[model samples]
Target: MPAAPLSILHVVRQFLPNRGGLEDFVANLAREQARLGHRVRVLTLDRLFSAPEMRLPARETLEGIDIERIPFFGSHRYPVAPSVFRHLGDADLVHVHAIDFFFDAFALARPIHRRPMVATTHGGFFHTNAHSRLKKLWFDGPTRMSVRAYEAIVACSDSDARLFQAIAPGTITVIQNGVDLDKFAGAAAPEPRRALLTIGRFARNKRLDRLLATMQALNAEGPDWRLRIVGVPSDITAAALTAEIDRMGLSGAVTLHTGLDAPAVRALIGQSSLFVSASEYEGFGIALIEALSAGLVPVAHPNDAFAWLKERHPLITLADFADADAAAGAIRGAYDRLARGEVTRGEDLSDYRWSGVAARYIAVYKAALAEAGHGVAATAA
Candidate 1:
């Protein structure tokens, strides 16, 4: 018999009104959980980091999930929000995203709330090479202790799994972030697309500068190639990105869009033939998979997550973004292959479907409840 529905409380620092890989992952997962008959509530901070002046609604329902925003102090890296405890009181299981303050706080509060807790390592703080020594020390000391409190630890990619597995070998599971395949499915034309598209938040590790350099190299090839960049702001500001674009002499050839609606994004995908990203790190490359779902050929930088992807999906083209000429050469080769009908679109990506990913989480939640003696199905096996 199917198990009774469970009440899920998701904890994340950034959410809707905040657009990025982590935010999108939580949104899509919560939506799917709601669809599967789970009562879902997300507890997040009140402000979007990009525009701190603009506050999100304190309480509201979005995409079928109940979300409540509480005030947070401290930096964006580790938001100190003790008030989240008030909201998560009703959840059967607390599912925390990222290894931040919430992950630690909820684990510490587990003894009081007496609810099973689980967390997803959304790339961790290893997104950049910043503070390598301190991060390693923290990972070994504090991160290890916090992880011991979780019923399950989901690593969004193989790379992440390997990292967490070293600390919490027994509890880690690899559930790659799911893509909304239907969102842009079959949006790309069969022939190679002429324009290139890149999407994500403007993090420094995204290496947008390297992408611009690649564009300059492409321009030297004498093709009238244009690039469109769509993303929200995080570590980098919009003004800074603009200055860099102008500095690269790409002001005339590049178009930048922020806060675009899904339809608008889909429209851009329909008009473009290629998708590219020079991201130095990613928990899992959701945008790249979304592009592949749209039937766009992807030229990705060889980050650990993207490298894991390239091994499974043979169509993905990996280029070393460290060198502009080399990256540009890869892009040019991808275009030529498309122009000659050497390859086709519509790659099969059923394995990364949300239904499968959400199902895994649902089972994980059930096992968590049973283990916590909350009276659900017994055995994770």
Candidate 2:
């Protein structure tokens, strides 16, 4: 007959009520696994550094999956919770989300309770600021060490797979993040007024300054376009972004939205004509995919993560990351084409839905378990 259910443990830095692409991915994956008759649980830090006010329960069941939050103590930015090791023996399989985090290192260092261990390298080690020698040394060292600890490593994009291969060099699988297509269901109708949308936290790596400059150049062309940014801002970057907007006299043209739920974000995208991003890097552009599903033409900086996508979707317009003026020109050109009705919607993204994504991960999980000599029959216990 039928194989039994497998017990899976997912480890991440934070969980629901803490908004981000990674958190969403983990939550969705766990929900799908539970729906497929597998026992799934999420383990994360109890405290959220960025949004301390939005505290979550230490133990709770969310969307049919169990979540356990371990109390942590340290600097708000990098809290450490050694107690996760005690719960390591509770699952048949362990999947850690990011390698750069403290919990990943702790999980990798300790015994895995004789279970198959897998790690999904969301961005790999490339997100670190190479300019800081100490930071580079600290992250890079642990990253390489952690890479060797997993039986299989999942990369969200081909670009990320290459980065992980450079370190550990084996059993890396490329499984792009999934998008809930139904949530963004709508026709590709451009708004009467030109509106560009981008979403992410205000981090230096996101390069929001470049996005502002691009908006400045676009506004100078006399079209009077509007740029909508949705994200929580860091203190320093928020001040810098606001000052730059006023200095460029774009206070009326640009809007910053914070604390938007998923439905609100989809509604914002549905109302926009174009989705734009100036991020220097991305493991997999989850927001971009969501925008594409919503039929918004994408205008983004060139990055290795999206190289495969650029080849498949001609509607995507990529601008050189080094030049803001050229990037702005590209965005304006795309907008002009949209205005002229040259392009209406993005390519069909039915393949990247959550059900298919969950199935792919299940296959990878089975392969990892089989390779470790724990066949499906054995894991069913």
Candidate 3:
């Protein structure tokens, strides 16, 4: 029997212009599945702030995947969208992005669609230290309800899977986020730029403040290294961080680069000696994967995913976040080792490539459909 062609649907807040690991994964996987002959479509929120003039009508096609963006009212915190439920009825399977933001909206809309859904927790909202009760209430209440609605759950790391299970227990799959190897290859000769780079949104959980403190402490010790921070910027917070950087006299030593494309980021990684991430918690360190592919030794806090890989690959040097001085020393040591070629990069990164990641998603998609009692036969796309 020929395999059934899946009419898969992916729901998220945004797809293009704003690029995060989950968004990249969905977009890449959608394209690959489309190439494999499955009909895949993406439903997203057309947030005004991100794309003010984005007149994405009710329907459009992007790279063989159908793209639909409904205007949703909420930042990454509490989403309120009425139209999302109406759209869910049209797919054989639904793949949701981010649990905390879209969970309530999806839960409310689930009965209308009656389709089997799976969620990918993209981190940030759940793990961050709560400053207000409302944030906790919003997360805890909606997460419990959302888990019941989902037929299955997936996380980018084993730790993430555990976090997901805290809400709903089941067979949670660990599909690590992947990178485009072709986009990041070793330059002809990696020049000794002796620079450190960190990439991600300037969110509190990212613990960039700690990293800056580490850099300042390192400067005091001896190694005069430059630190480059890159990502999208929030104006008010950027001003505050800039003021602090100026106050610390780190304006010359630390450079903040914003809104860089993937190619640009890879080029920057190629020039840098080491990539440092002090994220208190991350679902999966896609930035580290990118850095590793570009020949930048990764220096991270003792994250579960980092520790899990540290046993096998010597490329990553894990450090304790509480000891800023020790973290700084580890960064310096890794930098020196990378400079002298004493720490050679090892590990087969092919499994984390987009193609491999897409194949894994295909396996999960098949499993979800199967569990939902949808019979899918093997057929060439």
Residue 357, candidate 3: Cα error in Å is 2.4
Ranking by lDDT: 1, 2, 3
Number of the predicted model whose TM-score against the real structure is largest: 1
Which candidate has the top score in lDDT? Answer: 1
Q: Please, what are the lDDT tens digits per residue for candidate 2 over residues 227-268?
A: 889876642356677788888888998988777887787777
How good is model 1 by TM-score? 0.96
- Evaluate model 3: give its lDDT: 0.72
Between candidates 1 and 3, the TM-score winner: 1
For 1-381, candidate 3 gives per-residue lDDT tens digits of 126677878887767556666667788878877777777888877653434555566677765668887876655455566677667645788888876456656666667666777777776365566665765675467667767777677788777777667767776777877676666666312755558888876667778788888888888856577888887643225667788788888898888876688777776676687888888777777777767777777889887767766665678999875677998889878877766768766457887877677667777777777777775533433
Cα lDDT listed for each candidate:
0.87, 0.76, 0.72
**Model 3 regions more than 4 Å off:** 48-65, 131-142, 187-189, 221-223, 234-236, 377-381
Worst 10 residues of 3 by lDDT: 47-56
Write the residue-wise lDDT of candidate 1 on 98-199 in tens digits: 999998888787788888988999998899998899999989988999998888899999899999988898678888799889988888755565689999
